[model samples]
Target: MDNFLEIETSVKRVFNSFRHEVDGILDRKLTGGEFRVLSLISSGVNRTTDLSKKLDVSASHITAITDSLVANNFITRHRSEVDRRIVVLELTEEAKEFVASIEQKKKEMIVRRFSVFTEEEREQFQELLKKLAEN
Candidate 1:
């Protein structure tokens, strides 16, 4: 129990640190939730229902995030061709470029953060994270 609690605290601290770094890198252009939604959309998770399920968020929450993305020209929605009742989300060309840039910046940041670790240590750490995620 104590070990689990320690792990949880460490995870929270790491997540908070990463969020702060990314937020600064993004210049506050989007919230973490918004960025996550956009990233998922870019990865082909389009429908609001799908996003809600994937993110474990409410449908209305996804709607609000999509609304902001639409307003910023980051993404656009259209009715699905096969099902008019279903709306699909897509990233605009500009948004694609923006996301790519953001991804590059994030990669750079991660590389910098992990620079102190040896290659084997980093690989082991990644494996451990994957194992935890699988659980």
Candidate 2:
């Protein structure tokens, strides 16, 4: 029990630290929720229902976040061809480019944060994380 608690604390600390670093880079332009929505849209997650279920967020929350995304021209919604009642969300060209830029920045930020670890150590860390995930 003590070990599990320690692991949980460690995980929370690391996750929060990384999030703070990313927030610093984003300059308060994007909240984590907005970033998540953008990433999902960019990765081909198109339906509001699908995103809500996949992210385990409330429908209202998803709607609120998507509204901001739409306002910023990061995403647009259209009626589905097969199901007129269903709406499909897609990234605009500008949004696509923005997503790419943010992704690159995120990668660089992570690399910079982890650069103190030797390559072998980083690989080992990844393997351990994978193993933990599998369990």
Candidate 3:
């Protein structure tokens, strides 16, 4: 409604800056897509097909991302006990710790960034963001 491109760019910058900041803190790099996949897996979307569906990506695309995660020792893939055809993905212990650390850092960063706003303002901002995100 108001310079849509500007709003889009600003949103992109916010996420990219957070990722960059986290990358610096961790002394490593991860693509936004990779981090998202890790987050989803951590949150209980374990099946490969399910992840593809949730992310709206193709199965092969998910596999490529998971393959890198596996190679990095961040995740492990196994066949479902009940259904060997389905591939289950789990974060390695190291990945759990890594994700926890990243979450903590992100929480602190967001808190600091939003500190300038009053509590009511923060709540309104959150609600507005959610409204914008609604389908």
Candidate 4:
């Protein structure tokens, strides 16, 4: 607790715990990376390059993830009408439904997990996390 390394490890453990919760909520239907890409696409990040930059991964990695999503019928890739060279990603109808369902489940899980914290504590914790993330 006194050392930065210990704090870092604790933070990592907390992240891992959340990831595990998400995995359970997803029922192993999607890997964490795939879920992330889908979430970003749903939020209107529709370009592979943008996704790569946002996720801080290589374009090739995005391509691979998109390929998997495509094969699973979770997304579609199309050429931009204004720029044929540019690829745009979009969620399929099935993906939209899936996203909604998963979001509900995640919300429930978050509520259950954070129930120990009062509203003010949760708000303060979120603000602290935002500050740390910004720095």
**Which candidate ranks first by TM-score, i.e. highest?**
4
Q: In angstroms, how far off is 89's CA in candidate 1? A: 0.8
lDDT of 2 by residue, 82-119 (tens): 98999999998987887788889999998998999999
What are the TM-scores, per candidate, against the unseen true structure? Answer: 0.91, 0.87, 0.84, 0.93
Model 4 spans with C-alpha error above 4 angstroms: 1-6
Candidate 3 lDDT by residue in tens digits, 2-27:
79999899999988887777667566
Candidate 1, 19-63: lDDT as tens digits = 899999889899989999989999999999999999999999999
- Regions more than 4 Å wrong, model 3: 1-16
Kindly provide the TM-score of model 4 when superposed on the true structure, using C-alpha atoms.
0.93
Please identify model 2 stretches exceeding 4 Å from their true place: 1-9
> What are the lDDT scores of the predictions, listed in order?
0.95, 0.89, 0.88, 0.95
Q: Candidate 4 lDDT, tens digit per residue, 49-114?
A: 999999999999999999999999999999999999999999999999999899999999889989
Ranking by TM-score: 4, 1, 2, 3
Worst 10 residues of 1 by lDDT: 1-10
